[model samples]
Target: MIKVETGLADFDIGSETQDVARHGGGAIASFVGLVRDDGNLQSLELEHYPAMTQKALYGIAEIAKADWALHAVTIIHRVGKLAVGENIVLVVTGSDHRKAAIEACSFIMDRLKTVAPFWKKEVRLDGTDQWVEERQSDIDASKQWDE
Candidate 1:
């Protein structure tokens, strides 16, 4: 199963993954990405298109399922005004082996960075906001999976 949500509350995918893996699989690999303080940013806000974001995430989840023996997958990306310490994203993938679970988790995150429609604005110390750009490295990383 694949789920995606955008809201103000935090997300927890590790517990869900563990529960699904208890009887259905071997390992549960999870990753949590948080907004950084960095002493240079005060506030951060994430923006994402409603229908399109969910569709892209589900597509990524399907790709993972096709490439691995995935038992379950969950992804949650929070939007709206957020503090420096808030959580940004959560991803969990389960499989029959550690290697597959770990690799799939990495694959999901890499794809999310490049292909996901989420946009972020970082508030600097001087109170200026800047839109985060998609880096060339991010594009290159996604292409590695294709080759």
Candidate 2:
């Protein structure tokens, strides 16, 4: 299963994890990304092209599923105004072995960070808003899977 959501709704990680774990897999790996308080960020507003974002997410999941023996995959990303320490993204992967599940989860996150068409705007405590730039580290992380 592949899911891509962009809204103000907060994801329930435990329920999602349980759903994946019940897919007859021995191991389930998950990752949850949260908005950081760095730079005195007051809130984050995420924008994306709805159709394109969902397509990109599904594409990434497909790649992981093909490369690994994954039984299930779930990805939920929240949009709109998110305060610091709020959940931003959730990724879960289930497989028969821990190695495959772990690698697939990591691969999905790395690819999503770079490949997904989501734009982030950071609102600082001083009431200043700036578009966030993608870090070179994220690009490098995604590139590792190419080899």
Candidate 3:
């Protein structure tokens, strides 16, 4: 099972975990990203082309599933304005063992950081806004999975 969702609504982590557990995998690993209060930022806004974003997210999940033989994969990302400390994204991977479950979740998140089409802007408390640039560290992490 592979599920992908993008919206403004916050996801229920408990429910998502239960759903993945029902798939009868031996282990399930998850990653949750939350908005940070960096640089005196007030809030963050994420913009994306809906259709394209969905396709990209699904593609990332599919690759992880194939490589890990995962029993289940779930990815949820929020768009639009998000307050500091709010949930930004969630990724869950289930497999017959712990290593695949853990590694697949990391791979999905690393790839999403580099491959997802979302545009992020930092809204500062000082009445300034700036577009976020992709970090070199993220690119390197994603490439590690390919090798």
For model 1, residues 110-144, the per-residue Cα lDDT tens digits are: 99998888999998879899998889998998889
Candidates by lDDT, descending order = 3, 2, 1
Give lDDT tens digits, candidate 3, residues 1-147.
Answer: 999999999999989988898887799999999999776989999998897889999999999999998989999999999999999999999999999999999999999999989989999998899999999999999999989
Is candidate 1 or 2 superior in TM-score? 2
TM-score of each: 0.92, 0.96, 0.98
lDDT of 2 by residue, 79-127 (tens): 8999999999999999999999999999999999998889999999999
Decoy 3 TM-score against native: 0.98
lDDT of 3: 0.94
Return the lDDT, model 3, position 118: 92
Give the number of the best model, judged by lDDT. 3
| Residue 145, candidate 3: C-alpha displacement in angstroms | 0.9
